[model samples]
Target: MPVKITLAQAMGTCFGVQDAIDMALDPIYRGKLTVVGQLVHNPQVTERLLANGVRIVERDQIDSITTEAVMITAHGASDSTKADLQKRGFTVYDATCPLVIRLHKLARFLEREGWFPVIVGKADHVEVKGVVGNLKASAVVYHERDLEQLRGHERLGVVSQTTNRLDKVNTILDAMRKLPWVREVRFIDTVCQPVKERQAAIATLLEADIDLGIVVGGRNSANTAKLREVIADRGIAAFHVERPEEVEPRWFVTRRHVGITAGTSTPQDVIEAVYQRVREIVAQPAAADHA
Candidate 1:
């Protein structure tokens, strides 16, 4: 009467999330630490850090904090944000993933050279906001229809939010190339490898014999939302939950196989908890049927 639960091979935290946590826990800045944003978009991680005495501060409140050093989240920030913190006499420990920093540098370089930068990302995401806020002449393009709005720009430089879907970026680029007055279009693929790998792994899961999908991460996490969106696109029932308790028993009633995938920011323990809960639900039916 025992039930079986299988987790995705590549589920849990990515390198960027690991790096951010490591940087935050570095010995030098042990006492009186403040993070500019949610460290990596996992509630459990944030809560753990909070219990450890790390303070999470909003962007506007960083200037008001009295900490010796403030950490930036893995989702990279603008140069201006760092400059502001430095102006306030706080040593800034940048926890941004190297890949995201690379994209920020590319955006600045392209902008300085007179190329209008086009960022393919959600406008409200903290990472995209930081990226766009740094640029002097850049625009955030979320959908393919936004392409028509770029009627006057001659030279276009394209970069994507580090966690965006590669296929979406490619589709947008292909559409931009068809614009009549657009002279030259150059795209720097900025999608993080971890995100791409996670997405691809989920795609493979969709093709498998799974009845439902469970995605775990912070509610405000853009990448996590995208993961849910990707799974939902397959027309299968998918639930994005932060913790195991959020899993609904009804979702598993008739399911023979359940696929579990977590975002880059999701912790290993949370994934295991989800699996354990699913197994618990499955076991009930098996027990009754056997009885």
Candidate 2:
């Protein structure tokens, strides 16, 4: 009696992550280039890049970098940060996702047009930081409560971190519509297509009658967290795990159907490992009720 296993259509690493790793591993960059940050959020991916001779410099320890050149993460960095790296004698290899590049430009353009820039994301997230850092003054908000921090600006400009949940972005957009004193609101939809598809896949998973959701990705991955959050909001228990062994057998005690999804930063092998572990748990004859 095999338990049914379902996988999301848009699961695993996106093209952006793949491209970043490819560029870093290429002969031209392999020995000479250092990455300014984790190329992508997945630990496995990071480890692989490290094995391939890519040096990663964390933001806190960025000053210690001695490489002649550095590759920007797929998440991107501010224009000033790029310029500063050049000034420090390191040639920059910008691996910013094209979609993210668009948002960075949109934020600057809005500021140039006199609209106050606002970012919908975690303030400390590297991607959001990069976006806001491009502007002299900008606001970052993740919820309605954060709106209180907004300075008095008659016109509002909004863009979101590419990996943020769409519902969250929409909530912020709706809030922007209600600012009575604001004369104008301009928003650019910068959410990535892969994220949107993965988010929508959550609904399909729930409709399929899965007892639980297993989200595979790095713990620091924002998009992966969003996947778990979406499933949990629908009242189904979900586990965000980086590897197969992280899935506890206790959780599968009575689960006959399980849904699996992976974040954009997750690699394909991690998802398969989790799926295999789920199957192993369900095959236990002694654990009669366990699916």
Superposed on all Cα atoms, model 1 deviates from the true structure by an RMSD in Å of: 2.5
Return the lDDT, model 1, position 143.
Answer: 83
Q: Model 2, range 83-130, lDDT digits (tens) per residue?
A: 988888888889999988988999999999999999999998989989
Which window of 10 residues has the lowest lDDT sum in candidate 2?
282-291
User: lDDT of all the models against the reference?
Assistant: 0.83, 0.87
| TM-score of each prediction | 0.92, 0.94
lDDT of 1 by residue, 148-199 (tens): 7688998999999998989889998988888999999989888988888888
Model 2: lDDT equals 0.87
lDDT of 1: 0.83
Highest TM-score scorer: 2
> Among all windows of ten consecutive residues in candidate 1, which has the lowest summed lDDT?
1-10
lDDT of 2 at 221: 92
Structure candidate 2, residue pairs in collision: 282-291
Q: After superposition, how far is residue 95 of candidate 2 from its true place, in Å?
A: 0.6
